[model samples]
Target: MLSPSRRRRRAVGLSLAMAAMSVVVLAGCAPGGSDPGAPQRRSVNTRLADEPITIKLYTETNYTLYEELAHEFQRQHPNVTFEITKERYDVLLQNAPRLMASDNPPDLVRLDVQTDQVKDNLLLDLDPYADAYGWDRFPPTQLAPLRVSESGQRGEGSLYGYGINHSVTGVYFNKELARQIGMNEPPATMGEFEELLQAARDAGLLPIMQANAAGEANMTYQAILNQLLDRQTVEDWIYNVPGATIDVPESVAAARRLQEWAEKGYLNSDANSVDYTSMVGRFAAGEGLFMFLGNWQAAALDSEMEGNVGFFLFPPEDAGRPAIAMSTPGSLVIPAKAENPDAAAYFLNWTLTNSTARQTVADVGGSVPGGDPGRPLPDVAPGSVTEQTQEAFQDVAEGDGAIGFLTNATPGMFQNTLAPQLQLLIGGRTSPEEFAAKLQADYEEDLAS
Candidate 1:
């Protein structure tokens, strides 16, 4: 549902960008892009060569899902081995350009912010592979973020990557506490949601356990913004569409709503100081009744909270409107310079088709596996939050309400602009109007560079 990692992986989307900004990558990922020399296309034929082959995978995500996938795949192809290097998700995004340009590059890399990679020719264009693998038939919305136009804009163009799993952003509440408060069903609208927040607060529980250190208050803010605007408007802005903007009245209104939440004691008093890990840990420890987070946290929560937790999408203002959530696939891409392009392509195809691979992600990764959308879903442990996450994802995917995280509107936008502005807004130092204007300004400045 979002970039915030769960279990063994986490990406502070804004932190990744603010840190990545200092590296000075190619023409600042200018919309006017470059065409890199293409990797040789893989044959769609069924068999792999018998000779020993090693696929190099670079990722910041700790191997909860990856190590298992690699081992399981290697089991099937005895000759195939893996060399994987784990980096912090932030470091991985920061050094992406240089790593991809080195004399030797990884066969596949986990890419969170790929605009720069795609624009600079660091990533392999996957349209050819998509054709070979029948990936062209997968849900278009699931593939939209990975599709880059000739101008480097996302949402439409040749496919460049695929998510092994897709994520969803929504509200996670303590099921035990929910029943105590006489709430049996998820709120049907925003008004109903706010009432629950008030009830949780009145019961002396933290209504929302979001942290501001990584600017996580923005998670709730984006949840509200998701419903206020249509999917295309937000996705267009995040995809760097030529004139797309988020400094609209709806954005301002969303900011004001969050500010009011902060002022009214819905947010924890120490939210400004708490970090994401602590917040999630505290929530699972039973300190908070509800939290805003991505489905990435589901598997971990399932283990820690056991059967105590439940998740739901942010409800729309009107029940008749579609439910929208901040979501994007956890994208994996083949480097343009990958040593074994065909093997990498074949492995990616297997992830989509292999039953064991799909189930491992659901059971271990706590994520909703992304494959042929028409295919049956893999089984999850009964009563695990994973089931709800998968259902929420279906609602968003079918509703076409999957929008990129706002923190990803531009690298550094969160750290340099949104973070400080949100902190100030919560502290009574900035108006919501000022907050929206400042965000758009920073976005424009980043794109201009």
Candidate 2:
């Protein structure tokens, strides 16, 4: 569990000016008269008040959770209804270019946190609305990725999306399995981690469940790169700084390390064909020693493994470097083409602060981005696996560490170009030098276009 002291410290560290702005917004909306029990007058300031509004939302969330939350939201605002649609992560990525070409795109869409399409102009800016509603309560670290430029623009003002919760990637291990293997604790360094993987293999068990079939599995590369490379190197490669290329020594070294892992049989043989959902199930069945996943998997683990999971920050490169993991805010953004931006914003703001909504997210095994809502999720056991998962996230957020996923933080055809190359390198079909050359060529072509 996150220490109460740490939470308070983080809350205090958030910008005082932002906090003051929030107070002003709340005060302006407070009832002008002295009837405390009376329903506060709806602000004339909102643009979507009584108009007929239907918001179309395109998302990657499970349909059941989406429907439940959508229903709860509609119950609060009887006049507002959402036309919700769902798709797999890859489908959304593949179709974004075509969808953006159409004038009638979904009013609300959940985009890949690390894609050029969304950063390029497919998404709408939310800063003006965010400022109006005092949504600045979220700290810079939590909000910056969704707010910054895809080209690595620093502090140039624009907000692309707002995430409902922040997600981090790390290692999920089975504690009982570790104990039975004669290892009593999680590995704390890169070398120890390698040893652990070897131990699992020696015990006739698959060491790691590396999901590599889809581009999504490349997230493991991103997580590992976070430890191996510096933040600026990440930014340069991702945003394609002039005169910089993806074939940089740091990137090549990272690719080579991944290939080495594969060569040593640390990764599962069936990795090339595994889907994320199936990979999670296999891990839950105790088929592997470690599973790399985002915090959102907490809910699935709770239902499938009964809160018996243990997580650790991805081990650092060496003792000198601070342990860090990939994290970004996953948000809801209303499109500029929406028929009801005002109503959509109202609904968005309401959900952001609603304790029940926050609880629903937490109960479903997702982590909330802002302050604690005081209600606990039903399935999340106190002082158990869920608590540890939350603590690990909070620690990364509070520390002065790098933020954003590598692929997400980078720009251009990074995933489409380098990710597949990484897959080939890991499968032993390509050497490290050959992988570097291909990455350089792809990056050059992207720049030419």
Candidate 3:
């Protein structure tokens, strides 16, 4: 399934450091473990009477939400302005480190590689601000992805970044297509879900819509593992905890399930040829009964298919188990050498605590509120896909069932390992055990490096 020589080459490519992270490290990310400095705490409460200041923000995501948030922030503090530079995700990844290392670094940036960037001292540790601003008011799980240890170990410790919104992954069903297949409710167990897929196939409808070419196969593969394994086991693997392994029975079983589905013709024969946008478009146009995807596609699907589409967690192995899904927070970071650290921290604090900002996050940002549960829910259109998305996020977040993305298990695992192995599996060139073994090997190699 995985060629050792090729795997070694990919590993070496990563070891050479993704070009952006290869940028010169300065001071070893807060040498000797000293604090970055106190955040601009007074700015949060003090009313700046037209005091002129501009904050530069570099981002590669959530353009609309950030644009809205910036406008609202400027509205409240008339003199505070934003110089936001939006770039493609890859371009930003390659350039952010050098830019952050420059004398006039952007005040804020949406960091995609925290573990790598933090090791270079490119990101400011936001622990002080978290303490001063009561950031713990939000669910602790919501903050886990944003925090990292002094050694750049992720999953638990000092806060490096804060998320504006959170995302969930699961099944997006076309109700109309499901009706044609005689399914009226979301399946509650693995067997029941497979029955639904079979029913759709029997009715001459494509059962699941996925683009293997764009690496969409990993979502389903991961959902299966989430169903079979407990939260802690999966978390251990993803967080790089010592002694963690992905070759366990649960993971092997999960891989087999995906292979079974592929053989049953539940997936499209041409799945390898389609791109992500086209795959979603085909699903929206009613080419398939169910689509395995993340909530990031909710807004667009709502716009395209409206009430025709509904979402649910991928069913657990046992119907009795609590539903678990792949989930994570949006990425935000402050540059270590930012010109206005206090103002940047102030904006971050406002977004997390302010009711108006939370509402915008839920409604305009098309994500659940990134604040505490006690806070009021955003007013979404009744029974809309947006409402369903928020409910899904709430269930997983409050139920302790949410887990970070599988791709996050290693820096480049998604592209270098996962995508190719899954392609081979779906194409009948690799067995399930072989597929799982390859993944475990790559994970171990990355961990060792």
Candidate 4:
């Protein structure tokens, strides 16, 4: 899910309360409703003082971080154990709906901002749990994206999930390669960044390292789009705020910039054939000058290159404006059919609020601490890429400029519309105007349906 500000605007507390009541009444009134005498409520011990029990957790992204937190939790409560199954995100996205509805669903699952699963009634309504656990202490903006309306629209109504971290993406540069090309410092404006790209290309080095096969070519396009458009315009488009549209002059120019880079040989000629891992590996091996990707890649780069790697948000279109990067909460949700919802919620809460978990996030997760924006972040390894990423993330996040990912605006956009359209743009098969039109058309189609 893109970060909270771009998520739909939240409904007022009373309105949300009334909506929850209505949804409950409707659920109970359906023909052949759940067994009237069946236990509809289960006891949840927040202290985890119950009999020995193991909670099954299914997750995506940074499983090591989750394992570390789980071990810490176990030290506190010896009787509680976790059975974790980590899967690739593509596989999870493909099967989450069925898995979430199974007779024995995993207690916790990572989920995107998409609301189709919520519409299917596969995820739990977290409002009751939030009340019981006093989760209102979390910043409301952070909680907004996890909410889904009764009518199935996401961003407001009933809270369904919680995130442990916020992620931001930007330019990752090989400092040595940059210095070799005589560009010693990160650019201060988009125009200067373009000049750096040309300089790298002139030196016979890969100016941009991207994996088209992994859909990063589209992300490169978005990074440029972020530089061109203001935050509110992009947010309104991504969140489906009424009257939002993507076929604007700035977007057209952003698309054109991608085509220009492709023509100028700034982007890797074989980008379409490269996988994400290989692309990162090539960059680490000194094959590329810059790679546009998320902070999640920081640990690997830092481990390999040490001080050779540096991160910076793309420069703003206006040199005077502060930079804003696309960001989202790294989120997890409980399935409606989960057998141990309480344990899962406990784990989620512990991971976000516990000091040990926060340290792990700061050190290895390549994301900012999730709970309570006012809380101080644990110090990361000194002079590390993780440290640089954490600083950049905090700057953008607190500056009120972090925006949503365009791919999350509508389901299937990354796979269906953006991936192919971007490939076409890079291949010189589609004009920028045409590319913008296709995107807007798809956006309107999804809205109409």
Poorly placed runs, candidate 1 (over 4 Å)? 1-47, 61-63, 414-416
Task: State in Å the error of residue 95, model 3.
Answer: 5.2
Using TM-score as the yardstick, the better of models 1 and 2 is: 1
Candidate 4 residue pairs in clash (backbone atoms < 3 Å): 3-328
Sequence-dependent TM-score of model 1: 0.84
lDDT of 3 by residue, 1-449 (tens): 12333212111111111111111112223423455432232222222334799999888643467667878888878889999898755457668888998988999887644576776677877776665566777778778888778655787767888888888888999999888978888898989999999998998999998888846788989998898888898888888788888888888888888888888999887887776767888998888898898776777678889889898888887877887988788767888788887778778877856668877786666787675555555666666777677678767866788898777777657767888888888888888888888888999887666
RMSD of model 3, in Å?
Answer: 11.1
What is the lDDT for 273 in model 4?
A: 82
Global Cα lDDT for candidate 1:
0.78
Q: Model 3 off-target regions past 4 Å?
A: 1-54, 61-64, 74-106
Q: Could you estimate the TM-score for every candidate?
A: 0.84, 0.82, 0.82, 0.87
Top TM-score hit: 4
Error of 1 at 404 (Å): 2.3
Which residue pairs clash within candidate 2? Answer: 114-408, 162-331, 163-330, 163-331, 164-330, 164-331, 238-410, 238-411
lDDT of 4 by residue, 1-449 (tens): 12434333233232111111111212211112465323344344455446897888777643356666777788877989888888756557667777877777888877765666666667777776676566787888788777777665657787888878888889899989999889877798999999999888888888998888746686788888887877788887777777788898999999999899889999889988887778888999998898998887787788899889988888887687876888788788888788777678777877766667777776667777777554556766666778777778767866877777888777767777888888888889999999999998998787667
Candidate 2 lDDT, 294-409, residue by residue in tens:
77777667667775678878888786566577776666665544555556666666555665776666656456545333323223456555556777876776675545554543
* Candidate 2 backbone clash number: 8
Q: Model 3 — which ten-residue stretch has the worst lDDT?
A: 9-18
Query: Which should have the higher lDDT, number 2 or number 3?
Result: 3
Q: Give the TM-score (vs. native) of candidate 2.
A: 0.82
